[model samples]
Target: MKITVKELRLILTVDNLDELIHFYRDTVGLETSKEWHEETGNGIILDAGRASLELIDSKHAARIDQIEVGERVSGPVRLALRVTERIPEATETLIEWGATSVAPPTTAPWSDVARVQAPDGMQITLFATSTLEDK
Candidate 1:
């Protein structure tokens, strides 16, 4: 299987998009590229790596019957991410910034990746890549 673009940004609609944006900006160091407000709610487009993260404030409206709340997500929260080498440092920074961990980082079998949670309850997974020159 060959693909040019292997991934796309995951979008999560939350109750408080502003709060989530603040956490990602201050705690996780991702920059916001754009923001928009519609009749339904607001949306923030974050410039985490290459793709822009879309956080739409639609949780208040997603509670009809079609949306099934996940184990980690309440309302319409998502498992967003930022690629980092020092998972420990990333986790520590999240803790220092009032982000509560749903569970501590643990290595996933068959892969060199770690999973953690951010405050406002975002599932974060850190994976290792060998494309770094130096940090």
Candidate 2:
């Protein structure tokens, strides 16, 4: 048997839903496609552009952590966001929006990456595919 998947939505049960929504939607610039507020619950769906699943082993994850953060900092589930702005600018913007900077912008073999811890304690890695010099 095979299963077909159309869209992937990562639902986060957060304590401060409003703040997280603001961070991802306003600070990160994801367009809000849908939102609901009711007795049952309140939620918003933000369009994150194209999404892809990347599976990596523990060793590889640790290597990536080391390269981006200079240490093993990320847990099993880390959110990697591909941003349009340069890494430094993006990182600074996130920090100003209440994210804690885990590491400075570092140049990796594949891209320029920076790590920040969200208010909900989620480690978010912001990366740009274009070279740092280009941005």
Candidate 3:
């Protein structure tokens, strides 16, 4: 069988976990449904829609693993979200929400598109493919 969705639990290796949390939580507007912590660690799990994106606290910088058949989360690929209408407004707000744009929002002959670098180094693309709408 083939796969359809991606769920990830990220081990957040950062100098400051609270900053990271604010970025993904308030900036990205992800809902924190569950929270777990120990003496030296903490984590917040997002409802994450169809799939989950979990953020964990780590003191040192190391690579994150992704979910495989036998394992969970080998790593994260740049997550892309598809949206309808108010794309320009949404993207603009995203910048205000603390996402640094890798490429500023622009409209092309084919579509309107924008690129941004999330706090977690995730590359996101926003596109308005009006041609394909209402299909």
Winner by lDDT: 2
Number of clashing residue pairs in every model? 0, 0, 8
| C-alpha lDDT values of all predictions | 0.56, 0.90, 0.57
TM-score of each: 0.56, 0.91, 0.56
Residue 20's lDDT within candidate 3 is: 64
Tell me which residue pairs clash in candidate 1.
none
Pairing residues by index, what is the TM-score of model 2?
Answer: 0.91
Q: 1-135, model 2: which lDDT tens digit per residue?
A: 999988888788998999999898989899998999999999999988777778999999999999999989899899999888999999999999989999999998889899999989999999888333344
Model 1 Cα lDDT, one tens digit per residue, 1-135:
887874566677677777778887766777777788899778887766654345555653243112222233433544535455565676667777767654455453322344455655665655444333244
Give per-model CA RMSD: 9.4, 3.4, 10.8
Please provide the root mean square deviation of candidate 1 (C-alpha atoms, Å): 9.4
